[model samples]
Target: MNKKTFLGIAALLAVMVILSAYGHKLERGSDNVISLHKLHTLAQKGEQLTWSDFENYPFEDIGSGLYIRKYEVEGGSHLLLSGGNINLAPMSINLVKTSGERIDIRYEEIRG
Candidate 1:
């Protein structure tokens, strides 16, 4: 085949690979970034998290009565988490960049 034909095939393959990778990322998403509305509903249903509800402990703390206290979610430039006295673990949040700003929060919970 000619050089031009080879280059065309190579470019098409590259585009296909890029699109496939992006599709996977869209499906997997981040670590534990749930919708704020869903989180609010969970809290309303008596689920305690690190961001909003501080009165309740939803997860155990090192096998103790308390399970989860604080959590953090990291993306690209956005940092969403509870920065207070309560802490389950130490993490850095990095917010991703897009056409518009998309905020996603992460948290850690103790499960037995």
Candidate 2:
């Protein structure tokens, strides 16, 4: 397989594993599961999202044409990359898409 394809698949798998592993804790009842674009309103104020805060957020960004799927949770967040360029700096992972839109995630775990 091509390197890009491999990396993309690997990244997607990694995200899926992380979500399927500890995402069952939230009290959304029956496994909230990756619910996206459907969110007309985001979480309440001051939620701990690595990066979900958006101004004039495009509905598509939620999950429409996504290849990976962006998820903002407490301990960590996950983003789907549609062949976007990723920038790694400090403690954050930022993926910039061809459209110039950016998605970021941080590598950290919250023990609560």
Q: Candidate 1's residue-wise lDDT over 39-106, tens digit each? A: 44443432233433422212213313323233222232323332333454323222233333433323
Candidate 1 has an lDDT of 0.39
lDDT of 2 by residue, 16-107 (tens): 99887555444344323233332212322222332334312221344344333343432233334232322211223343334455444332
| Candidate 2: stretches off by over 4 Å | 27-112
List per-prediction Cα lDDT, in the order shown: 0.39, 0.38
Stretch of 10 with least lDDT, candidate 2: 81-90
TM-score of each: 0.31, 0.23
